[model samples]
Target: MAHETFLKEIGGKSVVEQIVDNITNAIINGELKPGDKIPTENELCASMGVGRNSVREAIKILGAYGVINIKRAEGTFVTQDYDSKMLFPVLYGIILQKDSANQIVELRKIIDVGILQLVIEKLDSESLYKVEQAMKDLETKITTFNVKAKDIFEADIAFHMVLVDITQNALLEGICFYVDQITRTSRMKAIEKFLTEDATEQFLLMHKEMLRVLKEKNKNEINKVVENHYQYWEKVNS
Candidate 1:
């Protein structure tokens, strides 16, 4: 293939954006692969018919998005593994969307339900033990005298994360992790409400029900348990 074909001439109102699109298109089209060295700035500028400044700006954007890495002397290359930074754009988009609370709640419910099914199908003694331990930790945090809302909230996150981790699905894990981040403030508020209302036992019971559902592998009860799990969250967000 001609070197010029790797990044075609730019055509758009935004030179930097066009440059970014060209390079990303090359990647999606398999012209570029993980760890593959990107064309040099001069090469990109010439091929895309853009100025050095445009190429440099586009490269900076890509690097910030975790799509590529720049080594001082070794040159730039596509990232070889997942980077948490990649999720920032997605997190920002969801957060900025208007009337997103209902949508986020729906997304969470679907993900939680599907994840429960996956966990049940893939459950093993070791994973079960880890989940059990996570549950115990949450219980202890909630029952502790004068426990801070942050402590309870962290424990709650840890417990759910263990369940998500058990599936060993990287994509799913990333989605869940960011969704948790997006809802962090609202979740903390809900937790505070629970703590204030002395509803810690009720909150703890909901998790215990989740653990019970996991152990039983009762697909029939998955929906009910998940619905109950989100009631407080939905109420608080509403």
Candidate 2:
């Protein structure tokens, strides 16, 4: 249980998973540098004493996640820019764990509200377009159909992500991505439960108010508006 508290269960206890750990460890230990082509599947199979199928599966998984890149005509290489520093923290939901998901939401409130303050301080016209685009996409997704919960969820994530993006902070983006992944269940619940026709309209109004606040660039009221908008989360679940 203690182990489960920290690590996500990847199912079937696949031995292929170890390949990721081994490769990551290699990267961390400086044995494998970014942009360095890794051994071929046959070579990896021989070296790791694993079957080629497992090696290929592990490589595919890492490739899918951008940890590695498989050049079509060339060989697979460590993703030159893969930051191991952010890997584990992001993988485990910024280290807050599933048990502390409420704290994660609280952290989101703090980060997001802080972002609102920054955005209000520096409301670039270019950034406003991105924010408006995300809002439009979110509204479209939520109102579309029963077939697109994922679309609604993604737009929901993107709308707030634009808030942070406007601040131009890379660390905040990573941290928010972590928080978003961790709090996805609560987000989905809030969207499904409270985003009815009337509620979505109300939601749009709240966002419009936030955009207005950003236009006005008033910092003092940033927290109040952010808190008010986020009450939906508190209304449904932590």
Candidate 3:
């Protein structure tokens, strides 16, 4: 395939950004496959009618975003696998947005509902056992007297992480991981609120309810169960 077909002339401000968009669009459109060597700096400049500096800046940005890799001797290539660096940009974007607290809650609800549905479809004995263990750990943390809110928060995160991981989907896991990071502060605050209100047991019960619902594998109950699980979180976050 001629790689030049992926290149197009730039016609707007921010030449570097337009170049980035062109290359990313090519990747998205399947013109550039994983491990495909992108056009060289000179070629990109010539094809896009941009200067070499703009091409270099666009390449640098793409490399930082983990969209492509630049080797010392080898040419730049599309990443072949999931990269953690890709999450930072998204995480920062959400954090910097106005009313991000509510936005994060909404995002979590959508992701959690989808994750539970996937887990229900793919739940196996081993995965169920792991998830059960996670719930048990959270329960223990909650029941312990004088336990720090941070400890409970860690256990809570672990339970959800297990749910996300059990699906055995790498992309979903990555997205969930970053979402978790984005909500870490709000979730920690929620835990503190629960501890202050002496509502830790209620929180524990919520996790139990989630596990019960998961075992039942009832699609109808997933949304309600997830909504209930986030009640305390939504309260503190809102």
Candidate 1, RMSD to the unseen true structure = 2.4
**TM-score-based ranking:** 3, 1, 2
TM-score of each: 0.87, 0.58, 0.95
Lowest-sum lDDT 10-residue window in model 3 = 4-13
TM-score head-to-head 2 vs 3, winner: 3
- For each candidate, the alpha-carbon lDDT, in order, equals 0.89, 0.72, 0.88
Model 1: residue 77 alpha-carbon error in angstroms: 1.4
> Compared with the true structure, what per-residue lDDT tens digits does model 1 show for residues 1-238?
3547767655555988888888888888888899999999988877777799989999999999999999999999999898877777777887788878867888899999999999999999999999999999999999899999999989998998999999888878888888988888888988999988999999999999999999999999999999998888888889
RMSD of 3: 1.4
Clashes of each: 0, 0, 0
* Candidate 1 clash pair list: none
**Per-residue lDDT tens digits of candidate 3, residues 1-238?**
7767877766775888889989988999999989998999888877777799989999999999899999889899999887878777778988899999999898899999999999999999999999999988998988897999889989988999999888888878888888877788889999999999998888998889889989999899988888998998898876
Alpha-carbon lDDT of model 2: 0.72
Better of 1 and 2 by lDDT: 1
